[model samples]
Structure formats: C-alpha cells, structure tokens
Target: MKIFRLTFFLVLISQLALAQTKRNIDHQSLTWIRYYNILPLTEKWALHSEIDNRNFIDPICQNVFVLRVQGRYRANKNIDLGGGFAYFNANTQNPNNNPDYSVPEYRLQQDVTLINDIAKITFHNRFQVEERFIQKANATELLDDYSYAWRFRYRLQATFTLWEKEKQSLKGSISDEVMFNLGKDNTKNTFDQNRIYGALRYAFNPNIHLELGYLKSFQRRASGIDFYDRDIVRFTVYHKINRKTKA
Candidate 1:
C-alpha cells in the first residue's frame, strides 16, 4: 500500500511537470462569459446562437470575442446534426510597440453529436470539422486578409445529478476536447489545442440554465510556434425559447 501510494503521487507530479515545459509557457488567468440561446422553429429544426467574451485578467487584456450561429436538425433521439458559421476577432498584442492590431477569423463548421445514458449518467460525444480563414500579414502591409486551414475537433462529456429531491436539482459535469489541424497552411504543428473542464449546473425552472466552471486550456500560438497554458473561470447562461418538444 505504501509503494502504491508513492507511485500514484509520482505519476501526478510527472504529469504536471510535463504540462509546464520550457517552450514558452504563459501561466495566464482568464475570465470567459458565454450566452447560448436556442429557439425552436419546429419539432425537428432549431436555431442556435451563441456569443463568447474572453479576457485575460492579470494585465487586463481583451483576448477574443466569438459569435456563432448554427442551424440544428434533430435526426433522432440520439443524434443531432448542425452546420454553422462563426466569426472571431482577437487582439494580437503587437510586440514591436506599434498599435495593438486585430486579427479576424472566419469559419464554416459542421458537427454531429451523439448521446447515451448509462447507470443514471448521461454521456455526450461530439465530432466537428471546420474550415478556417484567418487574416495573416503580408510582405508590405500588416494584414494579408486570407489564409486557410482545416481543423477537426472532438469532445466527450459526462453529466450526473449531484442532488435532487423535488423540482430543484443540481448537476455536475466534466468534459475534455481536443483539436487538430490538417491543412497545407499549417506547417509547424498539426496538434492545435486541448481543453479540460469541470462544472456545476443549475436549471432555473427549465427555461434557463446556469453553469459555472473551471477550465484549463493549452494551445499553440497562431502567428508563431510558441505555446500558452491558460487557467480560466467560465460562466455560461442558456436560454430556451419557442420550444415545442423536450430538449
């Protein structure tokens, strides 16, 4: 028993050490807020829209803003399909002491989600593909206006009830997502990013749900070959509108 405990602790320490390598690790604190609104047009069709705001807390830098719109179709009880367009505007933080520049990115995305229930816990698996157009720098100007990449992403999530007596109940969840780039424009690294998160959720009378979470994100830098290790506090609000069926 003593040897087993020591081995387990050593393994954890090694994992943390591997995550904080010497290759440009930025230990950053982030605050993220998101709103998701789902409005149902029919029993089989819905409109999904979301907005996200992310900020770095220590130096008070505005990180990114994302706006997403999707059309969702419920194919069956266990499957959902969606196609979406997303716009991203991000602060680049010019290192040359020039004016702070903005990078704009646009994406077309398609996704499918599968859900299952086992032993009172629900599992969600999502697979997505994206075609991204990111603004780059030209030889003469600061912005080149067009660069393309293809990315693939997958996420797995599990949710279970914390406590439930009557109409009010608390739920908890954990999720992990991994992203990979697969385009000729992406040369240095094919591995893009990873996110791991855990959250507590509350449903306020079924029309609105609130989630508060802690997230750890690791990503390679866009313009350069550096990396970032970020710790994030995430808050999200979900509002359901014009619902004809249970979601």
Candidate 2:
C-alpha cells in the first residue's frame, strides 16, 4: 500500500511539471517578408538603398538592409502629399553558443507638407507603420503562438532653401520623429524611439537632386531590460520623375 501511494504522488508531480512547461512556451515563431515601391502620378520616382548596423553592449551584432522608391504629388501651391513602402531585413548573431537569428519586416508610410513661400518655411508631417514576422529553425513544428506585430511612427520637419540658381538649389532641413508599438502579444513593453535628422539637398535640375544627412537615434524597450542609442549618417540621391505645373 505504501509503495503504491509513493508511485501515485510522483506521477502526479510529473504531470504538473509537464503542464507548466507547456504554458511557458508561448513565444510565437513566424517568417516575414516585405516589398516597397514608390510611384508618383506625374513625376519620375527616386530610388534609394540603405544599410544599418547595431552593436550591443553584450557585443551582439545586428544589421539591416532597405530598398525604397518615392515620388511626390502636389495638392496645391502650399501643400503636397507623398507615400512609399519599404522592404527591410534584420539579422542578429547569437550571443550564446547557438545559430544566428533573423527577422524580416515590412513597412509603409505617407506624408503631407505645408509650405510658406514668403518665410521660406515648410512643415512636413508623416505617419508610418511596420509589421514583423519571426522565423523558426529546422526540426521544430511551426507554431501559431505569435503571428504579427506592428509599430506606428510620426515625424515633423522644417526646411529652408539656402541658395537657388536657374536650374539648381541648395536646401537644408531638420526633423524629429516619435514611434509607438501596437501588437497582440502583451510581452513587448512599450516600444518608443526618437530621432533627429539634418540633411543637405542639391538640385542638379528641375527633376534631379541629391541629399546627404546624419541621424541621431535613441530607443527604449518597454520591458526596461534593453536600451539602444546610436548615430548614423546617410547619403541619398533623389530625382523628380514628373514635371510640376506652374502655380
């Protein structure tokens, strides 16, 4: 009788342990892919490529690559609207003794601009959203634990034209952006990031221009476990695809 009771207790404990392990394995694993195209109704669109890298305090590394297309449309003498999408991929090396990991993401954004000719001032506001999917390793059945995650961002910018010629102009702008995260998984804490950017643009012609800029970025994770701060510089070439009618 005593032996039977001990055996029954051990079996019950094993079952409870198995149940707890199953409940804790709630991490979602999915693969994500994205594509972006910038098309304008009137003008020729510009093509741009971007690369970003991050180095963590733990010496872990991650990198991202982006390709973008963008075009502008005039709403009136003082306003314009632009929209674009981006394909982004991020890869991170394992900190522990394991294989590397990668996450592929897709994002889209649109903007509206208000211009003042007399003051040579422009107010540009933009909204953007992004979604990410996770990838799983071989030998594991893909789980529907987590399917999708999203983020929203807003930006405000002010620009001033410094010089103008018959076919060329030099301009400078400053901008600030804020980001928020909205998703189904409650595990991710509030995702917030801020950026300050400054850029110089040179118009070679009415439809062609080039831009160079530097960005300062700061990021905070909701869980309060990880924080990233960094600076990046970018060089971009832009072209106006369509001709603008005189106002």
lDDT of each: 0.80, 0.54
Can you list the residue pairs that collide in candidate 1? none
Q: Which segments of candidate 2 are over 4 A away from where they belong?
A: 1-40, 43-62, 69-73, 78-84, 93-101, 108-118, 130-147, 186-188, 242-247
Worst 10 residues of 1 by lDDT: 91-100
Least accurate stretch of 10 residues (summed lDDT) in model 2?
A: 24-33
lDDT for predicted candidate 2 compared with the true structure: 0.54
Q: What does candidate 2 score on TM? A: 0.62
Model 1 lDDT, residue 20, Cα: 66
lDDT at 182, model 1: 78
Best by TM-score: 1
Q: Give a tens-digit lDDT track for model 1, residues 199-225.
A: 999987576889999999987665434
lDDT of 1: 0.80
